[model samples]
Target: MKKLESLPVEELLDQLEVLVDQRDDGKDFLLHSIISIETALLRVIKSDPESDYALSIVKIESDLKEHLVKYGTYLKTEYRKDEISAKSTLKQALRYDQTIPLAHYRLGFIAYKQQAYKSALFHFQHAVEYQRLKPQHKMSLSNQQSYHALLYLSNSALYLAAEAQQQSQKISIHNDVEQTKIDQLTLSPLYKLIDANSSYLAQHAFQITDSEGQRGASWEEYEELIDDATKDALILDMTGREIWVRYGGSAVKLTILNAELLRKLMLNSSETVPLAKTDLSDLFSVQSGDIKIERYVKSISRLREKLRNLKLPLDVIGMVAKPLNGQDTSYYYRSTEILFMLIEYAEGGQ
Candidate 1:
């Protein structure tokens, strides 16, 4: 999926225009296009609205509202009254629940684009909540549950990214010289999810990936990184990966801890020291390939001893300590955060 957040303005707007134009172009999928266009427009709204762009967005937003009114009427009249088939009704309900999250996500992305961190937060928060409690669409139990978690993570990432940008002071919204500001709130739900589900998400995302990796090379956006032992390395719990999306038969899996970590991450703001492993097994459970937990312990111990010999703070340096007893951590590390830590623990072996 295209990360809509970083899209160039022209490309994003052009994509939106295409969808919007097609909605009224008398195509068979006009209604679907209408929804798609409307959703994409929310994304565009977060951009700095130049005078050149303002009127167009205003018109698009207006048109989208009109379409919603009309669509709702259709649902009440034709679709209601037991006229529509069960399947059709189900599809509509699912669509309804999906559309809001889609639009809100777009809006949040836009806010980030325009550097309106708080507004972006508002929209993204709505998207996440819509994930937990919603229109209750989708008939299949699994699809419904998956969709709920997927959007929850997706929205959480947007918020997380926004907060990260703020605290890191990397984002500068230069509306004018003196009006710029920072937005801070890190390690939200997605980070927790990554810490907990790093293994499963990596496994699933990699299972569906159709790309390859090379030494010192970046992944092809969709490729999974395999460790020397050859298991799908969820080394990096991508905040975005928690969308709970499955590709083919592969999907990110999480243990009971994954959910709990995510819940706490979303609610808490303090930095957490990672939980140390109760034993190597806990840490090793998440590892794959030929790497044995015993081997990992021996290796880690060697590394620690070496660091101690160097008179370095083994506790503060070298490999990051993980929480095995369940406590603070700079909690809420995205998938990538966990991945980085594992890489260090593995002594940077591919």
Candidate 2:
């Protein structure tokens, strides 16, 4: 992936031109090519910081701060918040520099705070898009913000399911070679987030009407859509030495400890199981202490990084922190909405 960003300037531009030309060719091809072009462009800009393209990106970033200040002023000055002006300024920032991920995220947050879920979803999606296309070698402020964008994007989708008007503009995630690529490249991560968050939403009182006009309580409609999008499942093999996550035509392997954590949650599938530091210490045979907790957390983080590299969902190991008595805290691993299977059982049943 890093190499993709390191191509020569002429080559990167040629590739980008080809991709831009195919922008309207089809969504699948467009997304695939766009990602490639973004990777190249990010590399090109890094290699030549003084380039016109790089300066344009920087200028857009500077303008984004100006717009944000204006947005803040609008919130403070108007008795009734001038959301329209704030949004207009942000959109204008995009017109000058569409690659500005921060602008998109700020716009998304504004819409989200205002309870405009559909608008929030659109901006967050673009934030995700820009973040995904950026070079991943180094961490930028925008990169850190993308994590929050993912969270907001998923929540926005859930809320949008409740909007009657949103039903009319259903996400066109149908089947075909191109559509499949589009779904894989663009929609899979969103579905993963929704799947991870579903259990949390399930605990609350809510109802959603899907694009199909089918109504269900507590994110059922969104969950069903996520299920449909997920054609594969994470499965435990008979040997118990590894975990296998299937996605489209590929699979990712996991370490035994990681596999067990997923298996424990998947078997329960609905409960948020408490996992104390002591529990982790016992499970991994590590000495109980802050060190053990740190190691545990690092392991989980690495697992997420691996899944992300595989283009699989980060929901593979979903856990939320809950404070225990005193200063101690326990992590609760939730089964949430992930679909899982035992490879041995699947084989035996077949």
What's each prediction's TM-score? 0.22, 0.28
Regions of model 1 farther than 4 Å from truth:
1-99, 138-350
Residues 177-265, candidate 2, lDDT per residue (tens digit)? 23334333444455566667655434321222211321223444433433443455443433222335444445666644455455444
The C-alpha local distance difference test score for the whole of candidate 2 amounts to 0.48
lDDT of 1 by residue, 214-310 (tens): 1222233334433233333233222231222122223343322232233223222123433223322221211121234344444344333332332
- Steric clash count of candidate 2: 0
**Clashes in model 2: which pairs?**
none
Runs of candidate 2 with Cα error greater than 4 angstroms are 1-230, 238-243, 268-271, 287-291, 324-329, 332-334, 344-350
The lDDT of each candidate is 0.37, 0.48
Residue 278 miss distance in model 2 (angstroms) = 2.1
Error of 1 at 265 (Å): 38
